[model samples]
Target: MLSIAMSTLRERWVAFVVSLVALALGVGIIATIALVMNSALTGFPGQRAALTGTVVLLSVSAGVTGFATVFIVASTFALTVIQRTRELALFRLIGATPQQVRRMIVIEALLLAAIGCVAGVVISLVGAPVLASVLASSGLAPSWFEVSISPVPLVLVCLGGMGLTALSVSVASRRAATIRPTQSLRESAGDPPGARPGRSARTGWGVALLLISLMGMGVVAAVLPELATVPVVYLWVLLTLVAAVALLAPALVLPVLRLLTLPWARGGSAIGTLVRENTLTMARRTAATTLPILITAGMSISLLGALETIGHAQSVEAGERLRADYVLVPEGGPAISAEALDRARKIPGVRIAPLAPTTVQVTGEAGLADGFWGYATDAQRFAAMTSLPLIDGTLEDFGPGGIVVSDIWELGAGQRVTVTPDGGKPVQLTVAAVVGDSAGGGDFYLDVSDTGPRPAEAAYVQAGGEAAAALRERSGELGASLLTKAEWAATVGNSDQGTGVIGMLVTLGIAIVYSCIAIVNTMVMAATARRRDLTLLRLLGATSRQAVAALLAESVVIAAAAMVLATAASAINFAGLLAALTQVVPGATLAVPWAPVLAFAATSALLAILATTLTATAAVRTPAPLSE
Candidate 1:
């Protein structure tokens, strides 16, 4: 039995190759991500110390990016495995035992997985400082960031990935085992493997998951509010997306059918009729492709939402907290002129209240070392006229002997701290309060009289009523500076919310298209191989057109069904991924935008129409002779 199974591999090497390649790609990504994450964890501290500051948000960027990277890799790999169905079917019929099939996939996958791991580790080994340099230039990171892949985890990642690759291949191979040996020995499996979920069935699962996902989130949030926030939100989006795919796919066919039947549609009813009929035919193929579409679409929702959230944090939110409508500083300060301030005041809705201009040395938290930043403000006016929320201490804290720091400034309320403001005297101040800040960036609110860093001073002003445009005009005229709440918001809106979503959509769109092409090619080949059968049908008086339409309708049906299943799967996995991300990334939330989901479903339906039409074109041209 073992020999027979093993022999089948040589006979069907291509099948094993497909699994190996797909599995290796997945393992490679997993290994690389693991290595990077480990290096990130290990190096953050040294990097932290070298760039020591008054505070650090230990839970932000590193964790979040890591989690996202993992999901992107996993989805990519799964899609790859699914695309190569033909090769797998052949091996089973050739007498390959499942165990032997599994081994062949694992061994080959291991080799490729190792190479990817090595490449990732090496790149990280080399790329850290190039990154640090860019950060330093941008004034974001200090000059002393230590970036390198440490020995411990990097090695572990490589080892672990091989194990994981083998495991994934083994699991996937077991499913292929159910393929009837004789049937598979003859030809490839259908584009997608399954049938459609009935409306009730899809709805039941969709509703169940939706409820469970939501309930789980509510419970988690009520119990662990902070941790649950981003995680719960992500799960919510994931569930919603799944339900949309499930509950929506069957319903999707009608729209596609309607689209094909539309009076104003591009092609005439014959082409359109054929297209519509074919859509119902390759339902399985369409559905399989929809899986990738769902991933891409679902991810787009999250990415866009993230960008929007981040952008909002940078702009509208940042501006509201800035509190100062305009700032007027001495010509000698950071250079805001009186004319600029006056012009700002002249703008519509402009109102100027008070100004506080003073200086405080900027130093790292706990006096860790490095350079300094200067804060210019008059304590009394600044405190009274700002939107800064005193979450912890009080306003009395903003003095040479007292202070309030940003939320991320990891210090106890009563802790005493001393720092040489701008390389000056190490003045000690007690923590009075910690103020709330909107954006994740760091800054301090304290009253200190020091001029250590660049003098170029900055003056704060309160202005209302259309002061923004006036400030801009004045800045251009007086050669000074002004930034309005809206202008400032636009400038700082880094994530640009939905702006980046197009890229994700395009990428996903391309993937779905590629899948469609694969389906077309597969169907065309299958039809070509069945020329004798088709010829017999043609002889039986089944018109080539009708035969083509029937085949197309079958494809549409199967693809549609697969699409239904995929939608359901997307909900499950996407939720799991979000939960993991929430555990890993700080402040990362999952939000599903309905528009994108609907768009993807519709897109899949359209592609199925295209694929079916294109696939039938080959067979319709010539009827094969019936005698086999």
Candidate 2:
């Protein structure tokens, strides 16, 4: 069986090569992510909170990429087995038992996986350092962070890759093993059957996955609404939906292709007819090719779109929360000088609220021991300058002896919590109010007297009409940069957001690269496997140019279907995310990064076109064989 598997692999190297490459890329990405994450986890001690976001990002990336890898590998193996239907039938005719056939297929998969995993590990050796640098430069990790080389992770990844391949092949092999030799031989002479035995089962699984995804979204929206903005939650939901779409892809391919190719199909051109018929006749192959593009386009749009939506929501929320007419920020220092605040307050009709940002250590609660960020300000003036969402008590209750804590702390009104201010002694203060979590806002608020003599980080001024202009001029004279409420909100919204987005993009880059490789590999494999069909077209009086054109048109149809399905997936993901966000951040709108999405779609289409046309052209140029 091993020798037979080796011989069969050599004979069909072109098809197996695609599977090998896909598996290799998958393993490489997983390995690299593992090494980097291991380093991040071990390198940061006592600063885990600071590295929490980065680690989460890495974990999500690994999970998504791993899912995609398994999916692509399974699809590749299924297609490869299906394409070898005739060969497998011949083996059965020669007295090979079903068990033997299955064993041979498994052996072939293990062989391919073994080689692929080794190559993948090599790829990771070079990729880890580069990825580490990206994380450090993006500020997601410390500059001193480095990938720690460990044989344990590498060995485990290799073994895991092999195991995954074997498992995927086992499932795919069942069909090949069960098919009657005569039926397979007959089917191989023409287009493979469109409907398979387990199609209903596949549909059931797909529907079940989709239902699970929706249920998850509903649960998040109704319960943990704050998690809507968390990338891992939405990303997992998106990938689940993508998997459902993938499972249902064969059923989706024909209908979508027909609609997408309507103009070309209705043109009464022979090439168009051939293209439509070819893709529809081999819907499984078309679906397989479409999966990569679907993943690429869907993921790119969902990740980028979600980031934009969340960022925009935060920005809008910030602007809406402030009732101030102008904001004054110090130009050259961390804190605004008392002289600047004095001058700003002297302006007539202007009420100023100076916010002194500081950190405080809490020794009472178990989790609160890491210290909390808060602001010291004149409670009365602060209440007048902003409309904070308060869950308990009122802004008026916030005074010299009282503190306002975020609801996240679970501190209720009138509860006493001991907090030590930076450079100050521990003091117990009463929680006068509990405010909802607001982005870019402190976790707690304290009166200036309780927080020592800290200077204001920024001042909020409630001034309108001529008072606003006068305050702005006065701010200039004091060498402080003055911005209107809208301008300041925009600045706050944009701050510290890019680091996260960049980190996510860096992680997503791995998946995108793998998807691109899969796209090319699948297209080339699909095209090359159709040498017989191309030869038939040539024998039926079609020119090489016509054959290639038809193939290219079919590739376009598949790419179009992929893009359409990807758009739907992304829209579904965005809708679910927005539903959750609306529960947390009211009036959250969808933010689609159309330019990047379109660019990625175009690139996917172009790769599909080139791979199909180039491979089809070569296949058609070969003379038809006189016998099988």
Best by lDDT: 2
Cα displacement (angstroms), candidate 2, residue 570, comes to: 1.9
| Candidate lDDT (C-alpha), each | 0.46, 0.80
What candidate 1 gets wrong by more than 4 Å, as runs, is 1-98, 111-164, 177-288, 313-316, 327-381, 406-415, 418-426, 436-444, 447-451, 454-460, 463-481, 490-492, 495-628
lDDT of 2 by residue, 292-390 (tens): 888788788878888778777777877888887888887755468767787778889888888887889987545647678889887878887788878
TM-score of each: 0.53, 0.85
Off by over 4 Å in 2: 44-50, 97-99, 187-194, 197-200, 262-267, 325-384, 399-403, 406-411, 418-427, 437-483, 491-494, 497-499, 624-627
Alpha carbon lDDT of residue 355, candidate 1? 32
Q: Native-vs-model 2 lDDT?
A: 0.80
The clash count of every prediction, one per candidate, is 48, 0
